[model samples]
Target: MDDPVLRFNLRELPVPMVYATHRIIRDCNEEFSELFGYSRSDLVDRSFARLYPKHADFVRTGHMWGAHLPGGKTYYDERIMTASDGHRFWCRVHGRTRHPTDPFAQAIYCFQALTRPVVLGKIRLTDRQRQIATLVAQGKTSAQIAEEIAISVRTVESHRARLMKAARLTNAAELVAWFSTQNSS
Candidate 1:
């Protein structure tokens, strides 16, 4: 699979796949271009940041994967990505770097679109709730979230309670797992 010939054949794979070097897209298959609504020409030599729904997501994803990739690890996550037309959808991303010592030098990523209704239930969260969810998914404690968000512990607890009810989850751990899974794919 590390052979250049196999890598070149990624374009023919049925799933959406991309080969990038230093975070810049070097090549992508037709399925990838079609899925993202970008032409091959539009993506080639472009920074992978363009696929993210937000600049913060781009930065956060980089931070989340930076340490693991260079150590010969495969990274997987679920997140919202933007289509060329600016619509967002959840996708499960699988990535591996060819050069473990310098992971960014060459990498391959595969994306699988997830079913939306099963995940979100079309439930929209308030900005504060979303912030809290993000923090929880990042493994922040309630106390840490309270201090960082400048809210009282009681207030944070109350909000969390409401979120759990809304999501129909039973506990903090469940809520965190839910948030993490939702954000992941």
Candidate 2:
């Protein structure tokens, strides 16, 4: 990676790549700028939160990184991301940290847009609810979701009930279907 040609190849590899520290973009390749419909000048030295669909999403996702990055795991997730013009797409994101013990101190991430139907878009979910909904959509059981989010199983059920009520659904199966359905314009 220290070789100039190697560096040049990676930067122009046609994958959206970014380098960030403390969740702020330190630099990004040309493909990344294009992917987000932003000039390199516009994105550099800015918080990555601007690219997320909601402030809640930004905050909630950071929690995931905090749990994994310190262990030097290659974090991965498929989530909806937003472009500068407000266009949203599902993308599989992969990230790694150079500073494992202080992951947010330095990290690199890449994005690959997915072809799946958009998720979590039709619902107006709060941060915690959205986190639970994501897990639910991933087919996680109530017990698993509770353990991951450090809440009680009963609390998880409460959220599921609330989500069902909000979506006018009757049960977990319907709740999952409601949350996963594609946008109908």
Candidate 3:
């Protein structure tokens, strides 16, 4: 039998999968295109940045996840992704690098769109707001978020306040409920 991990028919895979070179998509399965509402041709030779909701998300995810690839780790995260029609939704992204020594040199990724979206329509959050929102949704306290991301607790609280105001929420508990449909589930 063929080695399942080392060989498979990309086109026939049920999962949305992409083959990328240094984070630039070079090929993708049919499910990948369908999930993102793009043609395979549209993604080929394109930077993965285009599918991200924000440049900061792309940069943050890349640096955060790519850090593990060099150590032969398969990194996965649940985050937001954008479709071609400008619709954004939650997705579980999983990736692994074949060339572990030079991680981004080549890698494969699979994306699974969550059944229920956490972001319901065009609620645009600024880069910092998005970061703060993610941390908040993940159940991180203001102090914990500040320490993790190297920002002042006051700054974190301020962002949370703004988010609450924008959402017309009364408190942090409500704010969390307003943001996460259960972070990822």
List, residue by residue over 1-185, the lDDT tens digit for candidate 3. Answer: 88667667888899999999899998899999999999999999999999987787899887766666775568766688889998888888888888858889989899999875454434556767766777676677999878766789999999888877877789877876766653321
Best by TM-score: 2
Q: What's the CA error at residue 93 for candidate 3, in Å?
A: 0.8
- Higher-scoring candidate on TM-score, 1 or 3: 3
Per residue, candidate 1 scores C-alpha lDDT tens digits across 41-139 of 999999989998667678767765675688667977666788999777877888999895987788899999876422443457665676677667657
Ranking by TM-score: 2, 3, 1
lDDT of candidate model 1 versus the reference: 0.78
Off by over 4 Å in 3: 1-6, 118-124, 136-175, 181-185
Choose 1 or 3, whichever is better by lDDT: 3
RMSD of each: 6.4, 4.1, 4.6
- Residue 140 of model 1 has an lDDT of 74
lDDT of each: 0.78, 0.80, 0.80
lDDT at 107, model 3: 90
> How well does candidate 2 match the true structure in TM-score terms?
0.79
Q: What shift in Å separates residue 119 of candidate 1 from its native position after superposition?
A: 9.9
